[model samples]
Target: MNCYTLIKQKILAVITQLQSNGGLPADLKVDAITVEPPKSRDHGEMSTNVAMVLAKAVGQPPRVLAELFLTHIQEFDEVRTADIAGAGFINMRLHPSFWYAHLSTILKEKEAYGSSDIGQGHAMNVEYVSVNPTGPMHAGHGRVAIVGDAMAALMEKGGYDVTREYYINDGGAQAETLARSAYLRYLEALGQDIGEIPSGLYPGDYLKAVGESIAKNYGDAFKDQTEEEYLPFFETYAIDAMMDLIRDDLDLIGIQHDVFTSETAIVNEGAVEDVMDMLEEKGLIYTGVLDVPKGIEVDDWAAEPQLLFRSTQFGDDVDRVLKRTNGEWTYFAKDIAYHFDKFERGFDYQINVWGADHAGYIKRMLAAVKALSDDTVTLDIKTCQMVNLMQGGEPLKMSKRSGTFVTLRDVVEAVGKDVIRFVMLMRRNDAMLDFDFDKVKEQSKDNPVFYVQYAHARVYSVLRQAEAQIGQIDEVQLQNADFTCLNSDDEIGLIQVLASWPRCIEGAVIHREPHRIGGYLYELAGAFHALWNQGKEDTTLRFIVDDTKVTLARLALLKAVATIIASGLNLFGVEPLKEMR
Candidate 1:
């Protein structure tokens, strides 16, 4: 069991004992009590501050209550000791055998070792990388895609039903720009010899392929058609082509969305007007003038009255526009409809992953979803910070208009999807990521992904070598082996790190952050490397000792490390390498 599980039992036992002794009030709530690891590892393997939090309610000194609870926790065999530390914190150091036993559990459960039921099978919808379907995905888009995918994977392991979604910006000014770019390319393909791309039109050569494909399919059929007639066809063709390119880019980076929701489809299905009507009926919609946004006021801000939603009443900074005076629905209107549709589809929670550039929009979007759903919906918007690409200690610049950007495909093709996925997930999503192309591809300990994967691969190498030299190893043989032979400090230390795997999963799932998994994997790898180095320094520390029984037991411990690394890698859809090549 994980430390959390064991400590939870201890906390519950102590709370029950206190209740029986009339130390706690009758009908006291115990739901808020939690037992987790302390911030400092030296303090304890597990920690609980429940006594401190409950002291005021129970009218008792925290240290006195902690001492009372310690007696009950100390009875458990797993808890070597329970003592009150500074500020009345209960620090519980688990028995050494308690930690060592997790190695056996890891081997027993294999890849399913750390799975938990925290989610209770709740449904969660995560939408990310909803970039406009007018061009290839850039590095920023890649970050969101990878983050969202990894989050979903982690949630699945934590027992949640998750739908990975992409909201296609297919009906907007951007789509029109893409259509115009394709038209220009089409003209050039027809021997018109268009000069430099104008400032408003896309300049990337990505559309050249789209233009050629259209020419091959339609030939001269579009030559005589009016702008109105051919524009729709070109827009559809170009958007489809762009989506195909985007899908390929995602495939290269190991991201596949379960749902692709199109904003254009919302309008096509008349859901936008339906949602507006629903909100109007709720008295949440009204026609009013908007105060000009501070620091970036539009010249037309005070020119006329615009249709507005009372977002400010629901915690937004200002009332947002539903439609412009030009009789077109605002982007916010379509987004409101999209989210309402998602709510209607029965997702309990929806998470939107956006680039840091959209930080200002979070309040309004959250406000819109709140107001539209009458506060029955939970909309979480995660803003991912920027990524600065570097190669050989220098900046790597990417510009779509300048045709100098590196596509996701380029990075994936260069480093392979597994390395790309692992490296991308090695940092917090909100923190700015420094992607060093050279370091990521390096086959050395400097690359965190390589280091973790090598640990797993090295374990496998040792296991395969044992099997070749001593025949197949099994659980009974390992359990019956001199597990006490694993008495070395390095071996015991490795087992302790493996014992934290289930705790790491719980933390990652609780915070909805997958970077914690990467951190745990790195530590586990460090433990494995330490054990391997110890083997180099002392022959008896190696996986294959002279006695076959002891060797098999050590092999079992190595298998536990491989099992955890594989599970962690699977949680991120990262392929654990067989060897560091």
Candidate 2:
């Protein structure tokens, strides 16, 4: 069992013993008492605040309660010592065997070492990179793609049935613009001299390639037809081409979505009207006018009434428009229809991963979900802040409309996928990340991706050297090896880290944050590196030593640490290096 589980059980037993001894009530709930590693290593292996939480209710001083609980907790095989620290914190030190026994569990579980059932098969749908289909994906899109993919992996490891989804915005005025742009490309592909692209239209070379493909397919047959005849064909062709390019880009970064729900499909299949009828029946949507948005002024803002959704009832800043005065449906209406479709499809929870610029849109979108489903469905929108790219301490500029954007493919090509995935997860999703191209690509220890990978590689190196020295060291033999030989401070620190993996996973999964995994891996690497450096100072500290049982015991500890590194790297979608050059 992991250290956290072991400590929790001991704490419960102590509580029961206290109640039985007439020091507390028989039915006191001990679920809130928790055991965690102390803030500093000097305190103890684990600490609990059970006394502080139960002090007032039990009618005793916290320190008195802690001393009373300590007498009973000291009998457990896991805890070697239990002492009351300042203000009622009880610090507990586990016997060396407590950590030594975990080696067998790690070797047996292997890849499943850190997996947890915290989610208990909860269903979650994560939608990300729902970028407009008008242009190629820029650098910011790359950060969101990496962050979303890693988050899904982490959630799945926590036992959630996660669905990765992409909402394709292939409708509205943007669609018309794409069609017009493609039609212009079609004319140019036919060898006609078309002038420079107009100011408001897309001006990328990707469109030129789409134009060439259309020229080869239809030739000059549609040259005489008006836009009314060619617009539909162009729309279908352009959307398909744009999706193809996006798929290629996602593939480069190892991002794969299970569903590609198109907004146009909702309108084509009459789902939009069906959803609106449902809202009308509930009296949630009505005809009204939206006040001008805060902090901005528009000259042509209409004062006319329009169709609006009563989102303010559900905590939105204001009611949102569902239709303009011209009788055309607004983007918000189609988005509401899309979420209604998700709920109808039986998703227990919906997670939308949006860019930081979309923060203002989250409140109303959540309000719409609440109004439509009576709060049965939960919508959680995580907005990732900007990723500022720097190379050798210089900023990298990117502009999608100006055709100066750097595609996701360029990043993965420059730095491998493993580096990109791990670095993106080194900070919380909401925090701005400065991705220094120079630092991430470095081979030094400061690059966390390489540092963690290198620790695993070092363990493999020792294993290979051990094999050459002792022919073979099978796990069955290692299990029976005398673990009492593990005595060095570095060896003990490594054991402590391995025992904390399950707790780390539990915390990261609870907060829906994956950056904790990155921080934990870095600490694990530090432990492994410390042990390796110790080996340099004392040659006898090396993993293999003439088939000695102590040496075998050290190898066992090494294997446990490496197993955790591999498990954590998998959650972050980073490959564990078997050997570093």
Candidate 3:
């Protein structure tokens, strides 16, 4: 059970009893009531502002209402003490029995301990890592791939029916450039002199393989053809090759999207025109002239009436252009149709993961979703900052245009996929991350992934020894262990942190921050390690003691710890360790 949720329910029950006795108005709304941990642990384990939230409605002073809650809350079996803090805040320190019970629940529920039934299978669509099919993926793409996949996994734990999507960006100018680059390599494959890769085209050495494959199939057919005659076939051939390489890169990180939507397919199906006509019918589309963006010079300006969307009415800085002066639909127009199609497929919520460079694009895209879905769907954009590769305490040089950037394959080969995925989530998506090669491999507490895995391994080691030293300690015996033996400070403190896992899941899902899970796991591991070291320092405090009852109690506690660590790692798509290497 979630500790905070339990506290909230207890407070609600007290309020209900008060209402029944006419101490509170029966019709008063208590939706604003909150019960969470205090900012400072010194205040109490959990705090609430129910009195302050209902003071005005109940026509009483907040302190007076706080007094009433204080009396009723003190009588709760879970609460050891309930006090009125500043501004009618209720701070509570729960009894040790409460934590012991929660620990028992952890052992009984196993992987289902932290999961909540709040979602009820709501549909969610998460789109990320939609890299263009012009070349192989670079190290920078790894961040989005991990973030999106982990986020989807996190939602699945909360019971959301999620779809992982990849939108192929093939219908763009870069696809043509890819065709041209591959054609040059194809000429070289056909024994023709095609020296010096051209400017404004891909210069990656990977394209040579695509050209050789084409030469083996079509032979000399495209070598003698004009750009117009060979461009289409070359585009299709190169994009297919690049997509294969991209899939290989994603496979290195264990990412497989449920759907791969093609921009070309969306355009070919007339979805864009249909969306535009609908928008026009809603009076959201109009032909208008826009001012030159502030940085552009007047000499280079082209001012004319263009088909625009009324994005400004929905909180965009300015109206967005739907069609260019030459009657070509802009990328924004196609995106609008894409989101509309997603909404029509019956997803209740949609999340788009974008790079830091797309920060300014969020407002207009959200405005489009609002206009098109009539505010029936929720669209959230998660902006992820860049990942800087570091080794020997210096930056790793990488550039796509120069074709010297580190490919995802290179990094995956260097440090296993688990390390890459773990390191990617060490920082918040909006914060710049530096992935130091030396630091991640260190087998110390300084490395978070190692520390967590080691804790699990440590627990596993003890559990196996306990089986030999004691007897078969199955789930039934664990559930019936003497929890009252667990009353020491460090023992109870460890249980307190274990109780916070459900709260952690709730907060992570609400804030859309999977990095919180990384932090939570690190904290949980630290707690387990601290208790283990305490046993080493003090003989009486050891987990495996001579007294059979106490030893069983401690082993059950370790089992709970291992279960939670496994649950969290499972959600991250990483295997829980039985031994550290």
Kindly list the per-residue Cα lDDT of model 1 for residues 307-365, writing each as its tens digit: 88888898988888899888999998999899988999888778888889889888888
Q: In model 2, where do residues sit more than 4 Å from their true spots? A: 13-32, 298-301, 397-402
Top candidate when judged by TM-score against the true structure: 3
For every model shown, what is its TM-score relative to the native structure?
0.95, 0.94, 0.96
Off by over 4 Å in 1: 27-32, 39-41, 297-300, 399-404, 479-482
lDDT of 1 at 86: 89
Candidate 3 local lDDT, residue 121: 91
User: In model 2, which residue pairs have backbone atoms overlapping below 3 Å?
Assistant: none
Q: What is candidate 3's lDDT per residue for 257-371, written digit by digit as tens?
A: 9999999899999999999999999999999999998999998988989999999989999999998777878989999999999999998699999888889889999999999
Candidates ranked by lDDT: 3, 2, 1
**Candidate 3 or 2, higher TM-score:** 3
Estimate the lDDT of model 3: 0.89
TM-score of 2: 0.94
Candidate 1 lDDT (Cα, 0 to 1): 0.83
| Per-model C-alpha RMSD | 2.1, 2.3, 1.9
